[model samples]
Target: MTKQTGGKRWGRKATGESAQVRDGRPRRSRRNTFREDEDLEEQINFSDIKRIGVYLKPYLKQGAVILAAVLSMSAIAVAIPYLTKTMIDTVIPSKDPVKLFTLGGVFLVAIVVYELLLRYRTVAITRVGQLMLKDMRRDLFTHIQTLPFSYFDSRPHGKILIRVVNYVNTLSDTLSSGLINVIADIFTFLLTLIVMFLIDWRLTLWSLVLMPLLVVYVLFLQHFQRRAYQRLSNKQSNLNAYIHESIAGVKTTQTFVREREQFQTFQEQQGQVRKYWMKAVHIQYLMWPGVQNISTITIALIYYLGITGMGGVQVTTGMLIAFVGYANNFWNPIINIGNFYNQLITCSAYLERIFETLDVRPEIEDKPGAVELPPIKGRVDFNDVVFKYEPDGRNILNLVDFHVPAGSTVALVGPTGAGKTTIVNLLSRFYDVSEGSVCVDGYDVRDVTLSSLRRQMGVMLQDTFIFTGNVRENIRYGRLDATDEEIVEAAKAVHAHEFIMELPQGYDTKVEERGSTLSAGQRQLIAFSRVLLADPRILILDEATSSIDTRTEEALQAGLAHLLKGRTSFVIAHRLSTIEHSDQIFYIDHGQIIEHGTHEELLAKKGAYYRLHESQYAMIKTANGEEG
Candidate 1:
């Protein structure tokens, strides 16, 4: 299948190639192996931690409310145990109903206040988390728009989509509540520890005996958990990319009768995801049980010491019960902290992918102090232009120079991959030339802002992209402010109105993405209408009519003449008939212009242009079953 890259098309196969050697050596598929290598090299560094802090910085007010609520809740927790001790030791012994009733009312009020504070904290944390996600997704999407064609060309669309959607979603809970809860858990632990010591230092010290062992286990689990989650993320990304590719080429697969093979490939990719997911989950499951076992052991040991008075300290019934309560409170926070630590490790992997996408600076941004271009007269000049798609790659255009007068049509004819689209792409400044300049009306394209330059140019590609909207809305995409009548007129000018009106709802009929319901000729006509509405001073039609039928092409020729009357047009068409009457024709070959003249002038010389013309005519004759 051929994927559209701005004006150019890149042909790639649906299935991935093997990374194995030709001499029967075994190796992994290139797609899976490449992602694995990338994941293996990833690390969670300090810079990533700092970037996470930046997203959280804006939610300080919300954080403050959540912090206040958590601290208040912790204080109440510590006080409740003391109230129980007071009831057992003093109130009940005095046998005063008033005192007992007063303490009971206080207990009820404390529970109510704690529940209210918990509710407030939940609301505040949720608000901060959702807003942070919104900002991150917005920033990532905006940055993606400014990225150059090369960025999208190099990576699968599914990989990019995962970063913007799934990866950002993975961060929501961790950033919103997980981070603040970790802080709250630490404070809760410290507050409980101080209270436990004040009650009885002997039991407090006994509770801590098993803590070092728990710490050692967590440290051992951390290493394997981090690695497991990282591998799982890589597998998920590979599976996502494969799914996107398969859906896009489902028609081609059906045509080639490869559905069974495609399903097998999907099963293999999904199996990898399942394997890594189980590994990560197994490592996570160990954390809770390990902490729970230690807590149970410590509580039993505290009971034995207090009942037998082994420490030579007097132990009362009320004090023994109160100290046990403090021990549970102290150990519970440690478990919470351990769980938060696991979340931090998992979120770090997602954060790395999100930040990596943001760090890529746009290659085709405006220069410092760039100015908006004034209304152009459409005179274009390519002055000793040199360009290549890659920094170290060979030049696609080498010192190729050309000039076009305002209000003239020039045709570019060349073989496939002969830099025909590169010439037009340079004129639109989709890429900057490695050497020399491409100028419009004596202004260097790079010197003007990209928006201002592109706004004055109309570009229609062979693969016309029709968005999922009504016909009128899609055409109005060319000029957002265009009125309904104006949209109809442009469609009429491009001869698209007749077919559009035939749809169930006329111009208001809804179309699917990429216009699956529309015929190739109909889609091209709508695209042509869109370009006509823009009415750009410089127009580029790259294989604009190649998809349309011969009858439709003939009808469009009249509309094409009207559209090109006062615009400086650059047309690249494979059909020789479309450019036979162009003001000037340049036969491009091997990144160089080998012949240039009008149709008659080039034919008189019997050069490369004449040979191309003769071959095309012969093919036409053969198709009509006529003697050539």
Candidate 2:
């Protein structure tokens, strides 16, 4: 073995005749051991490897102990063949019983010591490998979390998950399996070769004639199996997409009585997997037969040459036994090297995905030297802001400017498709403006850290999202450290305490997945309580009561009014009753504010807001005699 280093990087590349096959074999046809160094060097961006090396610094001492154990264990493994040689060549043949018994005793003792060192080395390597895997996973997860929303929007979650699950796992696998196989195989192979040559060079040379065939077979496995594995990964990701979409819309399927259709769709997808699995299996099937043929050929050569004594040499029985035992050694390493090669190539695409996410620069982040937003006064402003969802989509907001004064309530009313929601999205910094800027309390929203800016605002959307947890934990999600008393108080303030207390375990009851156990009205009350616990100085109520029954809406309206007082509030309302009492109203259409005034002023003008409010559809009632 030799090390090749340049730019302080390590690679093992055998050169010239060392890479050649044995005599009497066509060496030029055999595959070379080393990869194309320049190709790998250019492709594998191991920039963070230096960081990984730093992590290994603390483990060097333990690593040294493990290395010593590995070397000693290897020496003991090599000792077994030599001891048999000694018994056959000397003690037993000399008819010296005492010498035979002493050799037997020493062999027993060596086996005991070897087992201890082997166990210790296994534990040490595993412990170090696990620690490194843990640190690597943490860093990868953190990097992924910081990536921009657009990154996730463009990429599938299953593809990203494959990176987190399978790709990162490969970081340690190189050390655990690929590396261990190479070292153990080379050491055992080398020691056996030296011993076989010493016993009879002619026989050793003949035995090695089959190596070229073995090397050729392994290279084919590496190439074909690698391609198969990639297809397998792609097929698996497709299956994940189907499963995610199916589960997400299970209700729609059931409502339409489409269970059979859904099952048929899944079966079609599973059928694809079966086809790919067969291709992968067939490629794998070809490898073992190739290997078995090489082994069989080597044994045939041995018998033919040995029986004829054509080389003018008498190969002893012990030598033949040792050579047969040595031949079995090739089986496992040959298979493992092929398997590792397959895994390595499959993970390459996954690693690219993970690294791409990690390398993304967030669209919004705290600027250099950004300072804390101290004691906000609840003032909000958007100046000459122009924005659109896509570059080709109609401008969601044109050159619009708006302001909400401290200690005031402002309502934004418009027909459907008006940019009412966009206004609130800008205020929350869910997105930044395409032109101009939004400022909160004299600080640019982008200049302030996201966490700092978000801490000062409370948002209640039309679609209330509740995670799977008990009522207490869900309310406390707003402020994780809130005391139980504070959580209960917030719930009571929102009129949610009555409904929560009636559940199976009061605040401790587990809300089913996505809070399916709760009604839309019940969930919204809990969501409002969640916002109340955060105690933001600026609040957004964007159709906050849209999904509730009239009675529940009425019960919470007073508390909502109280919550709105003394805070810069922006309310996006479709229902005229919700926003009629605001200090100011902005009637937005086609991404522009066509009118702005008090509700009475807008009503007097008989503009867009007035038209929407006057429509009979706005007050349609159901058979239950409730407002639509």
Candidate 3:
């Protein structure tokens, strides 16, 4: 049954080119190309602030405790100044020892209570900050896992790492303590202002005369400060991306003797980081000193008015002292509020990047009411299939049509980039068809849940990935519930048991990431064991034996033949000898199948498949003749 399909593509193509020589200069990695536009300027918006508030909602009880502590602290702050005035104006002059000692004891107690509240507030704020950081990182990581392959393909891994780790950390303090302190500081400012007014309204007005100057200075610095921080963040991400890429490709760099060149590139990126950091730090430093200078002027004005009696209001020594204390209390909160505002500006840069990542909807999410696929007999069909990596890109697969009976072995023979792997990718639903249906057991792959559909298929790519773990554990990854005995059986079937047992600890021997300690042939054997253990209904082997020696390849054929029994399989390989006996052989080129037949039938036809076979046969004979 043929179904015609055409619609907007779900994923965008990455417009990065591979590294190559051009104009006598070695080109950069594709990952670095995408960073060019990543530093676009962005302004913090209300939505970003509102989303941060959502993360804070779960810790409201703790926030309330913090609020109560702040208010109680503020009340004590105001009351202490009044107590000082009472001691000087009334208690000290009374000449009564009882009153004097009683006032001194009360002052000491107030100081102790204030310190205790301050300590509690610090602990509470830290607890809340840490909790919010955990939640933010969890949500970010969870969302990243759901994003389509294209999202990762377009950007460097280091950029994503920084957002999950560094950016989230940058916002934690601002979202928790910074936000709470801003609120507390405002209230404290009001309390101090009111008390000062009651003491001497004239002096209070004088203290606030320098407020306009402070406001103008803050407004002037606001735009430059935020922009500087944003640039710094961009530069930091670029440097991290280069560092990660360098580490991953260190072998290639050393093999090519390009260490000096790589180091030069590293220095250039690091210099950018340092330059932007200095710019941002310079802007941030200006804010504190500017506020402090304004604060100093305000205090000087208050003292001048109170001491000189310039406004003709009589001022007693105790009233003057109490008013001065209130004035300090008022300015301290302003300083705190200014610092919080600076923190808000800095965190806003991080928040924009974090929310931008979280806001991307997964392009390949299950549709509403999608159903789980039941176990299948592995009958697969590609009906008029057409695909493009990009919406407007050239077709990677065009009008391809085929069907495979259940339990049949099919070989896809083609040159590199001739849509061989893409065919299996569609069958596995790693990508959706651009204009056709990929159906297994008559169910379109997209109609089923991803986990249920992919669970029954095993794919081994050209590059085998062996995670960091013991040999036994790595084999068990394919089927987590498999027994140790079953793991050994699978390894033996793939001809991997000999080498595994040869290791110092046998199956318990630990391998580093990517199996760097093992030979390429050994890694391929382990990968084969992993896939075979799963007992998948369908399997795809894309150049699975490319890394193995001729002797090992010959040994693996017998085990592979037994595993392939009663399981539908697709094989892609350059060495045609391995697939000469496949139930069906397809010679695919330029996204189209040029020839299709069994080995003998294609040889009789004397077409593209026959010519390919003859050429490979001649090469082997020539090599043997030369050796003889």
Candidate 4:
């Protein structure tokens, strides 16, 4: 390809081009994709290209149908120009009105058939694309669910959200539209070029001489467009993170009068997005005009050459008309193909971000031979347990040994960041212990299947999470098969039934997102009610009653006394008054259990537990003095 070809292929706005006279030897023609096949040459980003090809598999059938329709339309559409040639050569110069009428009728029928075919083709292909998208989306969601929580903890929530929503949507749209259109354009362009050559090779060669320049223009657009879009994607992720944090902490913002500060930050980011978007649009704006002007000049060349070269032969009006039609049809696809090239480049970053998540291998997964753990005798033991969140973060637990006799209740107490919750997490196997073993009924927790192990231990995390559903539905989330009457019974047992019934729609009232409509204590009650319905043999409650008022706490304490009668339990709470009823108390400090006994025994010993208990007493005394 010549310099003109290179320049046309690489759009004017393309930034990566080396000037023809660079450093030393003439810029060794970069391996032109237009001139070389994959088998004959190498690809710059071969792996990325291959991955893109894999994504196209789901749309292959829809693509085939689209190809057939587009080519059919183009073939017939191109035929009209050729038919005009025939009429000019044989009928128009002869001025046969009968032939004109007959030909006009034929043209009318062709147009009707073409319109109907395209209509059905669009509908059929759209339906197929939608079905494929549905399946892809389902697979993406299911795969994400299986990923370990650590993956999410490492990344910002807004980044994950953008990949899930925007990236997937872009991939789906590209597969459905861009991929189909590009393939059809290639097929039509090639076939039309061949026909034009057969009609008159000299004219065909002269008209497509500008093809090299067209290719250069397209190449330049793809390069800059890629960078522009990638910058825009990063900006979008930042904007998403800001919005997520702002909305999630809306109350905190209002409490501290930081609304204006947040709004200013948001404005700055929004302006950044506009800047990146304009950079991309600027390239696009440069592209169409350049190509249109170049083509318009090419059109003038065609008209000048046609009239001059054919003067002696008395060439008919039909040939001139046909030449004009082909000139118009020829470069439009090049323009379309150029636009698709940019679109393909822009969505590349989106594809990479999305697949990066999908490709992640879970740190821990169920073993091949892992068997379902059957009912156990409710004995638990922690032998030399040691654990931490990260290689560098503070240790949440250290090597130590502890055991609970079958069906006994144990309460864990600690200062903030003392790793009390870490123990619960280990037994639940959310994170495996860094050192030591945790066993239940003689089987190591890690040896058993995750589903079976988790199913057997009921957990109520400190932060109560309730899905957006009706009151009854939220409770039933713990055990999907639970009947409505069973759901009501569980609520009653937990003292949540009375409050639930007072809601406008009773059991059917909708829980707003994050359970926002309900008070914190009310939300806690629903969470416990759900746990009550689950009825696991091993119950581990973390700050379970911290939100309840004195009256509700008394009622719940009474209900829990009856509920904990025969079940094994681990209770962790900050309120010294709450776990005073436990059979044994384990005081945790710096990830190690320092003291263990009944509450009175620990207080009498005047150890770490004694100091913690007295601090709470002092706070109470101060409150009483102020009230007096």
Considering summed lDDT, which 10 consecutive residues are worst modelled in model 4? Answer: 1-10
Q: After superposition, how far is residue 11 of candidate 4 from its true place, in Å?
A: 52
Total backbone collisions for each predicted model: 0, 0, 0, 15
C-alpha lDDT of all candidate models, in order = 0.83, 0.70, 0.84, 0.75
Against the hidden reference, what TM-scores do the models get? 0.92, 0.82, 0.93, 0.87
Error of 3 at 420 (Å): 1.3
Better of 1 and 3 by lDDT: 3
- Give the per-residue lDDT digits (tens) of candidate 4, residues 106-172: 7888788789878866776666656656665666688778766665664556666777777667766
lDDT of 3 by residue, 155-244 (tens): 888888999999988886786588788888898899999888888888888888888998988888878989998888888888888888
* lDDT agreement of model 4 with the native: 0.75
Residue by residue across 1-628, what tens digits does model 2's lDDT show? 0111111122122111112222332222121111110011113233433344555566778766776677676667666766776777678789998999999998998899989987886777778877766776777788778655555655456555656766667567654434444556566667767776777788778877877877777675666665665566566556666776788789899999999998887887777768887887788777667767776777677777766777865766555555555555434445555555545544554444444445555555677887778768898787777776544445677777877788678888777887888788777777777766789877888788788888989999988999998899999998999999999889988889998999999999998877888998899899999998999998898898888776877778776777778888888877777777898888887777788889799889987767876773445544336632
- Which candidate gets the maximum lDDT versus the true structure? 3
For model 2, the superposed segments whose C-alpha errors exceed 4 Å read: 1-67, 114-144, 151-176, 191-205, 299-315, 330-335, 349-361, 390-394, 616-628
Rank candidates by lDDT, best first. Answer: 3, 1, 4, 2
Candidate 3 Cα outliers beyond 4 Å, as residue runs: 1-37
Error of 4 at 426 (Å): 1.4
Candidate scoring better on lDDT of 1 and 2:
1
**What TM-score does prediction 3 earn?**
0.93
Candidate 2 vs 3: which has more TM-score? 3
Question: If the candidates were sorted by their TM-score against the true structure, best first, what order would they fall in?
Answer: 3, 1, 4, 2
Candidate 1 lDDT trough over 10 residues, lowest sum: 1-10
